[model samples]
Target: MTPEPNQLLRPSLYVGALVLPLLMSTSALAQSAGGDWSYKIAPYFWGTGLSGTVATSPALPPADVDASFGDIWDNLDFAAMVVGHANNGRFGFSGDLQYFKLGNSGPTPGPAYSSVDVAITNKIYSLNAEYLLKTSSTSEVWGSIGARYWSVDAGLNFSAGTSPAASARSKNTWVDPMIGVRGRTELSGDLYLVGWAYAGGFGVGSDSSFDLFGALGYQFTPTTSGIIGYRWLSVDREDGSFQYDVEMEGLMAGVSFNF
Candidate 1:
């Protein structure tokens, strides 16, 4: 028997809520011990562009209608993460817990009116591991992999004068496998430049997607640093009325502390 949609999403929420706290606690303990553990907390912001296709089938009397390139606009993106790294000045390992939110609103074609207002929101949580491939007195390179939990909700609300006067909403969840690379190079005594890119996919349902990012940072001390960056993320839904595609590129700044 197939599980209900809510049934599937509920478990993901529960698991994320339970695991996030545990990871945070473990990271804290490692920090107090002065082990090869370090943590970074940062807030990120992005501007977004969105577009999608909506299909209405004949069974619904729409005769297989298609809505293309629905709408595009700039969006405010927000994200925060707690990351821990263990680097013995050479071989290294890292883990991260991250949360992100993206939202946008715009005008879309309506049945009998010029357009209707639509809004979309996306929330994601990720846990990942990294390995350093190379480290020098001024630069270091690393690769990473992990699991991502994602949730998206989208809706359309018609104007008061639009025909049929309607609204629709949808939600989906997925577990994606992710991989990426990162590097850092010193620019001064207490400052460094940083950059990274990550991509992932969910093979089942409408969860397939990819994300890429790049950033630069400044070290305030031996164990603390601040960074700024940009990212682009996209996801495709295999079975739905809508095909999802979004591009987010903007400013992100955050801090990291190593123990």
Candidate 2:
């Protein structure tokens, strides 16, 4: 069933209400330096575990997964991730790209099949426009509005033993609206911290979603830093024959290069 219009409008309106004050403050702090933008690029790694229920095909029932990074690594095919940021005075923009693939094979419980093979892949992209809320020599905070695009594919093949071999595959994609805050501060000489939290969806796109990350960094040089962090992400949505309600969390490591 389609959602009521009001269900969608309410969250957007709420986001607007909260952002109004931030806009006012940003205007007060707006500077004339439009051409003096700074940029940074961070390539990151997340060793994550996925836990929850998922249904990729209408012909299959939802399955509960509690796969650890180790479990996934056993069958991992490829993975890549990077984040980029650009700032001009009090205004900023950020983007992230991440993708990974996994394949596994195991014995089946039922006598009809001798074994089961599975393949899964995920791709995510995020973009945000932000305004600096407060800034100082040692610390800075920003408010942001963003969107995340998610695409997932899953496939399974059953080996014939007592029954005929069969295969099923499915793919789905969606985008979610997000709003949140992010910041960083110096802890001591050559040491610093960074993180961000965001919540969105509100039935406008998916049902709901949330993302959070925190990290500690060591400055290697004026233009480079190495960071270790933890990240938690959750997304829930079921449209038509597709369902993906899952949470992912684990260790994160990265290097940030400023330019």
Candidate 3:
């Protein structure tokens, strides 16, 4: 169902101000390039703020939305994300999964209503196939093609509601085709630089979508490392009269395991 766009909270996607490096060390992945297969997994946290315009139906004009990192933190009910990568020879693949829930409550006049509550949940997934375009003992560059999927659910409920004052819910889902390139190189012993960018949509699903990332990684052991960086992501979509333009920017941190 589509509901009126009401300055809904937006989580934006990943990517940010500093070309956020990452917890997943691509340099480590580069070091593993060979005839044998290698794998890595990592979990990430993004302290993000979001801004944009949204409309459930063109019947109503789009509304501006601005959500600060602090506001999101206060209403966030849950969040989780995991990324995995595997490669053999010059070919490989990667997958990412993320989920988040946000909620808000407001008091209302008595008599018929007491309070109103709003809840929003989001789920996202991406899968990509990769091919090495350049490689060295300490660095590598890859070309990739992928698909991303998104699902959003929003609902509102009122307490002590009278006749016709019920609850409402809205849900939306879509997929986008993407292409991008990423690479990493050792800066010095045990330290590396990484970055990647991708674009999609093109009217297939959304009108347009983009993601950017960069980071520095530190390897503490053969199988363990960590990273910190900034990231930014944005997407524009329209379904019938519904349209949404969303942008997310934030800081990122995470740990990775290579094997």
Candidate 4:
């Protein structure tokens, strides 16, 4: 006999309730064990370029208009993240919140003939259930899958000389599935090396697009680590055309704490 619709929903609801509390309790226990939370912070600098129809606009003037445009366009791309982990011997879990920002001066010679600046920012939060494949007194490897919530905003500013400026902004948000793998190796008694790669996608305002990032970290203690790394991101715009693409490449640094 087939199960009723209500029965099917009940089982999933029960499973979610059980799993969520168990994960929460485990994390709380880790925090009390000298495995308390820790944090890391890093900032990077980079350059960006625009392509497609947006790049080909006739409003922008020539590229060599001002030195300030060159400097602003090439500088200040960075990402920041904070993460927390909880683990028993063989299994553990982690959650992270991250932010990234990129900006550049649009090429001159567009229809406006005024200098235009573009800035894009992304914010993401994720929770993952992890399984430790292997762990020794000195090293560990793990993999995970979970859910992610993300928000992105893009803004454009137009300015002429030192006068007033005008701007436009667009924003989007979505939830997606996420997965990752991470590993750590002891370099010495108090020092360790760590690395990870995470991939995910969101469907909002456009067809689902994915993001992938890799990072490296150095452990200061069993519960705390400092990290520095790079991320490359590509997104399909909501414009419904092949002519618009949003891409980002930059450096990132952050910290993680295990509880």
Candidate 5:
């Protein structure tokens, strides 16, 4: 038996309702603080390939999915991402939001199905507070604590010969508390290496989620830079009827401005 569309999306809706307000409140607080605030905004492109399994309800077994960056780009219908940072002295706040909607058509198992189409929407938001532990003209390091929220919606439609199309959908959302470190080192003249890694979800929201990134950046001007990096991120979560164990990794490039 297939689940209703609304049934699959309820979890995400609930999570959004609970978390969005917190973000707004944090922003308000930051603005009201009287101090010289420095800011940075970075917009980037990630050519991430997806490799994962998605299972909905016990009735439907997990399906393996493998898509290259090329495949993902072809199916991607919409995408938006932004990373923001604000700092006052050694105390600071950073946040990033990423959203994507994609669709693909392929073959599926079982004699009852001739073709399968899947549409997916994913949103990931992270907000963190960090205190600078060390700083120098050539390097800096910070310790961070934050929460990351993930919400996903997937719709699957199956085509069975001589039978009407059958559709199933699922949505799930969770928030994980994470601790990590971010740092940068000057490698050469106007060149730097930057990296960050975080792990969370010790049975709190999901079983576990880990994110890692390393980038080489070059300063183009006093307040602008270009960055190229490789990133790996994975998540394993089982909440009631929704289950997902997935990993994404790829190359990314972006531009940043500091003011």
Candidate 6:
């Protein structure tokens, strides 16, 4: 039997269903543990631009890409992003999920070429265990370690003159060990500064991946807050005939709820 074109997305979707429930359960568990347990959920948007190179075949050189946020928005077919955090005492857990599909078309370089159309699907999941080094009313710092799972499916189709259309597809999936640090400091009564950074890969999984995020937040209520921030992420991977090197950076905004 032939597999469906979207079959590549099932693993992440199934895992996400299982993990999201666990994230919700953490809040109840934390609430039962004591006053020390705290849980937060945030839904965010990242206006990311893509910049890098991609190669579908060894015979062809990698194509350079520089896409702005508007380009991605124009090409985006679907997207979802959400994050959750829970802590009890000095021990805590964090989970983040991101998934998207994009499509783009461009004219071929020379007269012999008509047009090239491309589609990309990406899914990433991050789960971490964290430990706080310092904690106070005004400030706190912590470090975390976990795994990051990545899956990407890409396809290209093109037609030139009267020739039949040609198409190619590639898929890559891997898990990497990730480590990072996060901190928050109070700037005033209801305002705070927060930052997080992490990296994964060491000749394992993909060649390398890193992320940086920072934000300023204002508490609207004891249980809710609004955040504005910036984020940058980069990834490099090479597996047989598949190769992808990309970076995304943008401004972000979100709202967080505590329970």
Q: Identify the candidate with maximal TM-score.
A: 6
Tens digits of per-residue lDDT, candidate 3, 1-259, equal: 2222332223323422111233245545666654577878877876555566544533223444566665656554555567777888789887777765655555544445555565656677788999999999989999999999988675656566452344656677899999998888888789988778999988888899998989899988989989888777788877765555777666777898888
Off by over 4 Å in 2: 1-34, 69-72, 103-118, 158-165
Model 6: pairs clashing at backbone N, Cα or C within 3 Å: none
For residue 246, model 5's alpha carbon misses the true position, in angstroms, by: 1.1
- How close to the true structure is residue 246 of candidate 4, measured as C-alpha lDDT? 55
Q: Each prediction's TM-score against the native?
A: 0.69, 0.77, 0.72, 0.59, 0.81, 0.82
Q: How far is candidate 3 from the true structure (C-alpha RMSD, Å)?
A: 9.2
Which structure among the candidates has the greatest lDDT? Answer: 6
Query: Can you tell me which runs of candidate 3 are displaced by over 4 Å?
Result: 1-35, 57-61, 68-77, 102-119, 155-168
Better of 1 and 4 by TM-score: 1
The candidate with the higher TM-score, 3 or 5, is 5
- Model 6 Cα lDDT, one tens digit per residue, 1-259: 1224465356447546865797768867776777777788887766566667665766433445566666756655555567888887899999988875656666655544477676777788899999998889899998999999999897767666455566778888999899999999999789999889999986699889999999999999999999999888888999887887887777778899998
lDDT of 4 at 212: 50
The lDDT values for all models are 0.55, 0.75, 0.70, 0.55, 0.76, 0.78
Number of clashes found in candidate 4: 13
Number of colliding residue pairs in each model: 0, 0, 11, 13, 0, 0
Task: Tell me the lDDT of model 2 at 253.
Answer: 91
Better of 3 and 4 by lDDT: 3
- Tell me the lDDT of candidate 6: 0.78
Per-residue C-alpha lDDT of model 4 across residues 174-259, encoded as one tens digit per residue: 67676778777777555556667766654433344455555556777776667666555555544421112555555555555443
lDDT of 5 by residue, 1-259 (tens): 1234664365345444644665566557767987877777777767666667766656554555666665756554544456777778999988877765556666666666677676767888898999999999889998889999999887777777555667778999889998998989998799999889899888898899998999999999999999999878889998776777877767778898887
Please provide, for model 1 over 104-144, each residue's C-alpha lDDT reduced to its tens digit, 9 standing for 90 to 100: 43444435533444455566666666777887888888888
RMSD in angstroms, all models?
8.0, 11.2, 9.2, 13.2, 6.2, 5.1
Off by over 4 Å in 5: 1-32, 105-115, 161-165
Cα displacement (Å) at residue 36, model 1: 3.7
